[model samples]
Target: MRIVRAGHLPPLLRLPDGHTKIPGVPVGPLLGIDATARFPEPELRLAPGSVLALYTDRSIERRDSDIRSDVERLQGSPALLGGGGPDDLADGLLRDVCHASPDRADDIALLLTEYAPPRR
Candidate 1:
């Protein structure tokens, strides 16, 4: 999976030119824009059963000793969380994260996409 495209979505925040998609890339914010500037480098690759896990810093923020436990709990319950698709999981995780932390200091965004063989 090449980094077909990745970036912030302009909604609650201000964006230059007010456009999410640039000419060459698809619809989304470029990874290094604004609040997204601190995000680590994006990585993409094609592999069997590849799962792309993305999350905002807020997802792991907690007074609890280990937030990974929270993440693992969610990961263990795919059906309970959402059974639609990559986009659905992404949306669900974002909603869940926000609900878990209503007063999140930073905007929370998470996307989990898996690279699977296309249906024949």
Candidate 2:
């Protein structure tokens, strides 16, 4: 799949075997600031049962926490790796990460997609 991300935050991809962080290329700049900004399209061949997660910065940002460590924790989260639907996983992530802080300054948004090949 071709995933083109053009912002400051990157996304996460979880496969049946492992998980990884998809890095976004440094595009010209954030949208609206540069109308002519061109982004690089990174592509990947996702295996069946792979789960892709796209989240906003608020999902990981905190007042006094290391984002890298939080990301690592998120990758190994049982809720993310557990057997559940996209909605369930999203809720779990939000509860485990964002909801822990009640003084968050920004809102969180998460989108999860699981890849399932067509059945014969």
Candidate 3:
């Protein structure tokens, strides 16, 4: 799973007041898997409403038909968000593909999520 350190969190080592008086540079880590090397702690931030899509390599293997059309058909469906979460959309897409296939011969995994900023 992708991991990120949010905000100006201090290091594990600290003083009694739980504050870093030593004015150290605060950093956040961003990580990704696949082709590039995974960053244990990446320094990147995402704005609100940002959508992160993580799909298995099999996502491009749906042959015998137009892949874009297949994806559009699922995205345009009303039941895509039945679970009240973006993750449901991925599940719905996979389910549609699996059901359409003659037999579920391959494994599929998909994750879609929207990043919402924390409310103060």
Candidate 4:
């Protein structure tokens, strides 16, 4: 998969074996922030059953903690570490994020997906 972010966090990938990782993607400037800036599209391979998690910063960000650590905390939460379908995962994620966050003044956006190509 190729990814180009407009100042968004790097996507998280959960392997089939249940190992989750934040790929080392280059951070790019937000769209229109740099008129002449160029973003790189890095290619990474995804194995079947690997779920790709893309989310907004507000969902996990906090004034008391680093965003990366917050993500790591979420990575170890039941939401992402537990076994379940996409719906279950989504619900769990929301519950965990909202419950842990002190204030809820912004909306949370998340997209969890997996690649399931048709069997040949």
Top candidate (lDDT): 4
Candidate lDDT values, in order: 0.46, 0.73, 0.45, 0.85
Q: How well is each residue in 16-93 modelled by candidate 3, as lDDT tens digits? A: 222212223343443333345433453334445444444443543456767555554444434343433456655665
Model 1's alpha-carbon lDDT is: 0.46
- Tell me how far the alpha carbon of residue 70 in candidate 3 is from the true structure, in angstroms, after superposition: 3.2
Q: Write the per-residue lDDT of candidate 1 for residues 56-95, one digit (tens) a residue.
A: 5466455554655655544543332334556665666566
Candidate 2 deviant stretches above 4 angstroms: 18-28
Root-mean-square deviation per candidate? 12.2, 2.5, 14.4, 1.5
Cα-based lDDT at residue 106, candidate 1: 68
TM-score of each: 0.45, 0.80, 0.42, 0.90
Comparing 2 and 3 on TM-score, the stronger one: 2
Worst 10 residues of 2 by lDDT: 19-28
> Using lDDT as the measure, what is the rank order of every candidate, best first?
4, 2, 1, 3
Q: How many residue pairs clash in each candidate?
A: 3, 0, 3, 0
lDDT of 1 at 4: 37
lDDT (0-100) at residue 5 of candidate 1? 40
Q: Write the per-residue lDDT of candidate 2 for residues 1-120, one digit (tens) a residue.
A: 787676656667777765555554343456677787777776777889888888777777776777776667777677787767688888888887755566888778788998999899
